[model samples]
Target: MNAWLDDWDGNIARTKGVCWIAGWDGDAMGLNQAGPSIRCGSLGEWNPDERMTRLVLIGTDIDENRVSDTLDRCLVRADEEGTSWNPERGPFPRR
Candidate 1:
């Protein structure tokens, strides 16, 4: 998780846009601009059984597909039967 956060921070620092992430504990929510500044916080209540995340990015030259692809890699995949969502092998690969 720390490694992923570090990498995400680095990416946001280099990106020429605004970015925000909201999720459960250990995951930070923030508004990152093109600079060494990020205003971060939580998204209120967190329900462990229903874990989810919402990320938003906006910019003039942002590649929508690239952003989607990158973010999609961070998601917790659904099971084959679509009856389960597991974060055990998420981007951070946590259980």
Candidate 2:
């Protein structure tokens, strides 16, 4: 999967949401416009040893500490189940 992030403007940048593509394959959808902010929760093959989430924000004057603190509050532990082993996608969010 691939992603492209674009900032529309400085005014409504914070309120902008992501757009999903039903069948996005090499620009075959024909919905090619501007300002695409879609992102995936993870990238590349799943690694059982490394279960992590990395979010990338496109803006000016970005503070690493502030973003990390805000994200810590926004996301919480889904469950307390063991995420040690999985055949398909290792270390999945507890369901």
Candidate 3:
């Protein structure tokens, strides 16, 4: 699972021209930054105008459907946060 996810992360970063980072916290898997969920943090680790980072969690035993749903929700929440994310612009587009 880790190998596959690493590949996926690399692919996302390469293809999207954005940083993709994730980690396991012994419970759910967390995405520190991915796709359109990018934003600046308190430390100013990211510049949304240039790059964005955000955290979203997907629990253990995840499947494709779960990943899709989580990303959709992330996009929605990002939009609510005033980000103009075009869901249709990425590999996963809210489906």
- Name the best candidate (by lDDT): 1
Model 2 lDDT tens row, 1-95: 12122323332233222222222111111112223433222223334454344333456666657655654643334562344323244221111
The positional error of residue 89 in candidate 2, measured at the CA in angstroms, is 19
TM-score of each: 0.40, 0.34, 0.24
Tell me the spans in candidate 3 whose CA falls farther than 4 Å from its real position.
1-41, 48-50, 54-60, 77-95
In candidate 1, position 7 carries an lDDT of 51
The clash number for model 3 is: 3
Clashes of 2: 0
Sort by lDDT, top down from the best: 1, 3, 2
Per-residue error for 29 in candidate 3, Å, reads 16
Lowest summed lDDT window (length 10), candidate 3: 21-30
Better of 2 and 3 by TM-score: 2
TM-score of 2: 0.34
Better structure of 2 and 3 per lDDT = 3
Q: Cα lDDT of all candidates, in order?
A: 0.42, 0.32, 0.33
Model 3 lDDT tens row, 1-95: 22233334322431122232222111122233364343321232443354443334333454557555545544334335434433234333112
Clashing pairs in 3: 38-52, 38-53, 39-53
Q: Rank the candidates by TM-score, best first.
A: 1, 2, 3
What is candidate 1's lDDT per residue for 1-95, written digit by digit as tens?
22334455333434332222322344434333444443344444445554455555544566667766766665544543343333353342121
Clashing pairs in 1: none
Query: lDDT for model 3, on a 0 to 1 scale?
Result: 0.33
